[model samples]
Target chain A: MKTVQNNTIRNGIKVALWEIRKLVWNKAFIISLLLTPVIWGLFMGLPRLFEKIGEPAAAPTTYIYIVDEIGIYESLSQKVSDIDNLFLRKHSGPIDDLRNRIEGDENAGYVHITEEIFETRLISVMTGTGDTHIPLAFNTRLKETLTRYELAMHNVEAGDIEKIVAGYFVSVSPVIEESVDPMDRVRKWVPPIFAMIIFFMVFMSGMTTMQSAISDKRDKMIEILLSSVSASSLMYGKIIGNFFAGLIQLAVYLIYALMFIHFLGIPGLGHIPVHQLLSYIISPELPLLLFFALAGYLLFSSIYAGLGATMEDVMNAGNFQGIIMLLPALSALFISPVIGNPEGIIAQIGSYIPFTASIVMILRITLIDLALIEIVIPVVILLASTMFMAKLAGKIFRTGMLMYGKEADPKEMWKWLRQ
Target chain B: METLLNIRNISKQFGKNTVVDQVSFDVHKGEILGVLGPNGAGKTTVIRSIMDIIRPDSGEIRFNFQDNNNFLSQIGYLPEERGLYRDSRVTDILLYLAQLKEYPRDRARKRVLEYLAKFDLENAGKMKIKELSRGMAQKVQFIGAILHEPAILILDEPFSGLDPVSQDVFSEEIRNLARNGVAVLFSSHQMNLVENLCDRIFMIHKGKKVLYDTLLRIKQDFGSFKCEIMSEENIRDKFINFKETEKIEQEGLRTTIYLKKGVEPGQFIQKLPDNISIEEVTIKRDSLHDIFVRTVTEN
Candidate 1:
């Protein structure tokens, strides 16, 4: 048994080297090796560049054409004046003629206000086109406008409402008493980067694993391979091999990230703090995040290898694969929403699901505090799922390797799984 | 001959359809055994069973597995479909395969180089599998199979795509391997090659064993001998007139006389005309192709 295990591991290493050679030695990956880090460095370095130049108050590019025919324009200006990224311009003409104004600048749209119950509540954003596909960010401006109108209606001084939107007060202990930590504000952005990178690496690498197995079958190399090594060995070799390959790519990206955060001194991107970015990188929870990412990746990749083996043809990749394929994207989608309610029921549910657990748990860890059990539970579940998937993939890959030339029978595939 | 590998009563069924039924054969050291069967006749299934690629539903395929050397590495397999990495260099793929078998790198590389040279694929060692011509690729794939010099070699349709010259090379190498105490179990659609290369032949029809015997014994027991005579005289009537003559055909000056199964060739040839101007008289045993056709169609 020990010898068998040793053989499997040895063969697996060979398999991994084989796969890595195919992937990393390719021209496209070679090009990406050099290009990806530069792109990543510049991307992560942009905020730092902006902070050094210090644009205290830049003029807004998008101006709103505000029309108040009921003689409330001056009063509205005093209360809900020039919102961030949206400056207000008073319009004298009727709202019907605003289409000509919109035709001149698509970004410039007129907001017409009418007196409703004397609250100045009724407003219409008039763009020339019938389908006014306004950006969702405009809703925040509209909500702020309504809030100021309500405050003005109550005759509270406009000067007292400098901070209109919902804001949180963060406390720092030593540096400045009662001052908000800038790190606390940007912490939400940190978790998603981990989640996105994890999800992207896992999902993309998992798909490549499937494509690779299928290519082996197509090339008729699986038979020689099977005769040479056990199916489990082959599976381990492929999974672990490609996993290391993903790590290499990640390592390249990390180097770029380090260079961007620590070295690339772009003055335009001076707003972001390097120390905050470094904190996230060197955070105590980082290891756990990486563990979940790997576990999730294995779970998905095993399923992919199994699917590739059984499907025979790409067209035959059915619902099981479709569901597995959607999982990473779904996990990534959970990232943004979980940032808001990290301790909510949806997040807790996501943390338990092996598919979404990697991103969800990391997001939860980033935003909220949890006991030891919360982290352990999802990781344990993910590890179990990974083993199960690996087993299923082994059986299916073994059976399907020799299935050659015929349409893969779904019934036979089920039998293999059951066996 | 000692049976190096014994397949006893092995049967396989895919769904309700039986693919291999009660199939049995043996491969002995220093012997070349041919497994001849028509298309869809259980040949590949039986070979795969021996390789343990698929488990047989019934019966045991026992190899003389040794602890000192990996038995799997001691067996070289050249599948009919001929699988190799199309994009990989021959040396790299060969090295990886040998490594999987636990072969030492230097020795495996040395053996691979030796075989590549022997098979006239020296330059192809650097080429990708897809870059090689079909014959060259087949040679490279064959070298890959034997680089470790396995004790037992199972080659399925090894000569299917080879030209005559390369076929001769394979035939020579197969005999050379058998002489060097390696067991070879060969399967091919080419009957004459099977007859020329194999010492013993096992035949199947519709997943059932129909004939299993030495090539000489198969000719002696299952078929009649034919006498070919070159004569100006009409020897056809003389042979047809004889009671022992089962089949008689006259073509130009040559006449072929097949004796009845129960009657020996000596019984009919003695009664032929002495004054028939016979120039040459040679007896021909049934070819493997003829026997194969007869057994399959009849069974």
Candidate 2:
């Protein structure tokens, strides 16, 4: 009996390998698998290229036209020169001429130093696209210079001006603090992309599971299979087969993605100062990511196998599979924000759930200082859910594989489960 | 003889229709039991129920083996629907299926090669199932079922879609298995083959067993003694004189007589005149096909 059982398992593996080989060699599977990474690489590369083309060649020299009778121009030039990499070009021209040149040249912008119109003691400043750091820093320096000049006209000491500016700085710290090192900011994106990569691999490999199950039934091969091996064994063998296949593809994508990023000299990639990028890529999270990936792969692939068994053909599996496919993709869409704020209610909630946990947990691990308990809790929960789902899927597979000509409904599945 | 398989009061219903009703039969060791029925006659259903493919509404199937623990592993099944993993190579698929039936890897490999060679499919073993012709694929399916050397073999419609040569090969293989004491139960639409191969037959019609007996016994019990007489005189005028004769029909020069129940061929022969030359005298028991039709229509 033990020998018979061993043969059953060995045969199960053989069946699984046969399934994988067929799928791997199929033209459609090959084309679809290759297409995803190529398209993703192109999309990731395109935007950086466009940004490089449209950026200004060099920073424009800072010029301010002062019309104030208080004579604050000299102090402002000194303040502008204090800022690193900022060159101050003082122009004693009409305000209208300054405005025309600033508007005409694309790289240039202007700041007018005049008495405030809205407030009594403040200065009015204007610039184009205020979002840049250069203009904002320049504006702050000019304000400081004017305030010191106004005080000096009343015989206030220059050292007291420094004291006053220092008094205005507040030491504000983040409320939801994270232990992420400042230099590791680039590492934050890796988890989401890693999650996406895993998701893509699992999804594509799941197509193999579906195809194998459907092909077996469609060709009437399942009857022979069932007569020899139990349906549960066949189902598990298929899921495991695809799981290994998924891991292979994922391994290739990891190598290819890193090489591609390195070859293209992506900014803040491998050459980053924090953890050498390569170390971060090989972080402890990698094994955890693999763990979660296997869990996620088995969970989804088992469901896919069940759906495949229940469906009359591969085409009929689409609507059922669409629901499963949308799950991880949808989780990936929301994973970024969750990573950014792991302590948030949504991330905390999603981390505990199986479908969302793989992406959410990876993202959280990268961006936040998660406790051992925090990490283990979701892993345990996801592992438990995977086991339960696999059991349910096995039952469904056993019942559904034998049924033909009609799709199994949820109620019927529930009934089978009861049995 | 020891009963290898006992199916007791098995019945199957699909929705509102009963497909198999109270069907009971047993397969004894070293015997080939033919299940003969028309289309929708529950023959396949009976086979499936025996395999436990579908749960019967009410039935119990018991198999007796030397070791009870190994009973399930000792049975081989071939469904009417031919099923082989289409993308897999013939040898790999056969070995895989054999393993599922509990054959070890080396043994499975050896058996697979032997069976492929036996079927003249040695070179085709490495070919994909999709690349094989329908008949070749069917042979592969047959090998998958029996590769493990099962004690009991159940095949449904094993002769369908086979060339006469292939059919001969299949029949010879089945005979060898039976000679080796492997109890075989097969269902087929080919009445002639069943008539030749079956020791005993169970005829089903509309979810019920119409007749179950040995071929000789069924013929002896339900058959008519037929005689053809060539006579220039009108046989219709003398037909009433013979109380043993009924429903005699004449066409051209041939006269056919249907012997009534309890009528003996010897008694009928004695009544013939010395001048009347009996061109042919045949005790025609119902052919298996005729029995199948009569059984189905009678019920």
Candidate 3:
């Protein structure tokens, strides 16, 4: 009893240390964990810095020159006050001379108003530079003002004009019974980003697990290990070890993200409506999400462990890792849509899926005011699926760890499982 | 002494090919049983089966433990393919493996350092496995296997990559383990080492045990007979009457003869010329390599 207890404790400690060492020492893990965050911080932080630097520069006031003899200068000046950043400059000359003067001047543009014999009003805009926002804004406002003047001259009422303008408005609100929280827009983007980070952490950590499993098989280290512990114990130890290492990375990233947000003096982070953030952190669905995350890690990692065992070389292990990595990555594409409409059928169905549910369900818990039973149902479903998946993965891992040389086929795996 | 391990008729097959055919072996208290075979002769397969890395299709592996009933803690194995986590320090890996064998942290550390010192690798303990030479890695692997003072030690091709000095050091270690009453089974392709070190050998060819006995007995049973003749009679033709006469070579006035089976050396000498100029007629024994090749090929 003492010896077995001692062995188990020792095995656990060793596994934990091995995992921590690999995470700390591996170049890829270090680069992803340390360098990637720094790089992202620098890249994302540049825009804010540019905005700060340009904030003090005074805006150049807009200047517009008119070349029309239509006597519309008084009406245009009244409309120019309503147009943002437009200032009218009247030039007394023939239209050709006004156009020449306008083209020669670098800071102003000419708007020529004309009337054809058919009694149709014509407007042409001439500018030296096509890229300036002021020229485009001025020309659009001038045209609207002239059209309104022509309508008013035809005895059009002001109420009619309001109606016409209102018809052009596009409403973005969906026809839902419940009022959508404005914060839902921001919340929708958060889940996918969180899922992406988790995906990266799982993938990089899964690679470490793969290396451990394959190195054992290649070097016959598995034999030495098996002589000291059960196959299940070893597999479980490796999974737990890697999970803890992943938690370390997650914690580090969270700390860095918090520091970044704090350093940049971004508002709304400090005032994130404590109730909403707390609801996210302490939701009843959180345990379920964590459970699923653990289960998903084991399920995916078992495939890698099996691959590592079945293959004779490290190079072949990489080929097997693609499937393990792709399953979670493919699930990530649906995270955004699911978060946008978490109460939808697609999101609810995804909440039952082992890979998608962890992110999808957590997102629903945070972004949607779901009923208690609805939340409980998905959590239960995911937990059950996670259990079943873990059982299957464990069986596959045990059987696959002994195989070598050739890749393990489904038939052989089934046979081993049955035995 | 009680039996530590009992491997009863373990048979393993890969598809239709039987790799370990109804092989039965046992390890008792303090015995170093050397398993000798050529490449692909199922030595490694049997070792893996014993370690439970690969399950034998049909076999019963019963372990009779002492006060500690956990069989895993009592067995130490070094596989044919040597490996370590290339990124981990030597001492860390050793301590981890010792821990797997159920050693406590302080004890594991002390034991690992002691083994490192014993192997002349103490200075290299802090370095990673990748930084060590192949010989040094092999030493570390050996330390990993035996650090927990396991009751049964199984080593497959442990000496394959070791230099002469390292091989000697490993030999001494194996001997020391045996002296401390640990059952040790080591597989090797080097028949000379087996001949020199093993108390008893189990020689398998094509997954079947062809010979399992003491080294002296195997040498005696399967050895060839060689005789030198220094006769001036030119009587090579006279020896043709012997039915088992194989090859007779003439060097100047002397003749050396190799006799075939079923012909006794005493009987062949009985027919030789007496009172001749025979300076010496010594019969030489066969080497283990010769015996292995002949036995494997003949079987």
Top TM-score prediction, candidate number:
3
List clash counts for every candidate, in order: 13, 0, 0
| Fnat for candidate 1 (0 to 1) | 0.65
Better of 1 and 3 by lDDT: 1
- Please, what are the lDDT tens digits per residue for candidate 1 over residues A1-419? 78877777877888888899888876888798889777765777688798867866564356567777555566555554434555568888866777676865645677766666246545567664554345445655565656667667678777865564455688556865643665555454565576558667767788888888888888888878877777877777787777777878877886666565566543544445567576766657677777777787888888888777765677766666566557677776776678889888889889988778887887787777788898788878888877887887788888877777764566787888876
Query: Fraction of the real A/B interface contacts present in each candidate?
Result: 0.65, 0.54, 0.67
**Which tens-of-lDDT digit does each residue in A1-419 have in candidate 3?**
67656666666566666667766677787788887779888888799899999796554566777765667788778766766566788877776776666564556677666555117555656665664336455666677767666667678898896575446757676677655664555445444445545656766667667677767776556666777776766776776677678878887786777566545533554445434533445445455445545555666676565555555666654444456546767567777888678778888788777777666766676677778787677667666765665566667666566665566766776676665
Q: Tell me the tens digit of each residue's lDDT in model 3 across B1-299.
A: 66888888889987788998888877877888989887888998888777766789998888878654567778888877557877778988888888776667798788888988988898998999989998989999999998888888988888997899899999988998998999989788888887777877888888888888877888778877767777777767766676767778888877878778556778877877664566666766667887888888898
Identify the runs in model 1 with alpha carbons over 4 angstroms from their true place: A36-179, A183-192, A265-279, A312-324, B228-242, B247-257, B271-282
Ranking by lDDT: 1, 2, 3
Task: Write the residue-wise lDDT of candidate 1 on B197-268 in tens digits.
Answer: 999999988899988989999988888777899988887777667777777888999998877776766666
- Give per-model TM-scores: 0.76, 0.73, 0.77
Worst lDDT 10-window in candidate 3 chain B: B273-282
Q: Write the per-residue lDDT of candidate 2 for residues A54-79, one digit (tens) a residue.
A: 88766555444445455676777777
Identify the superior model by lDDT, candidate 1 or candidate 2: 1
Ranking by TM-score: 3, 1, 2
lDDT of 1 at A275: 70
Identify the runs in model 3 with alpha carbons over 4 angstroms from their true place: A1-13, A45-103, A108-200, A218-220, A265-280, A312-325, A329-405, A409-415, B13-18, B38-41, B57-59, B220-282
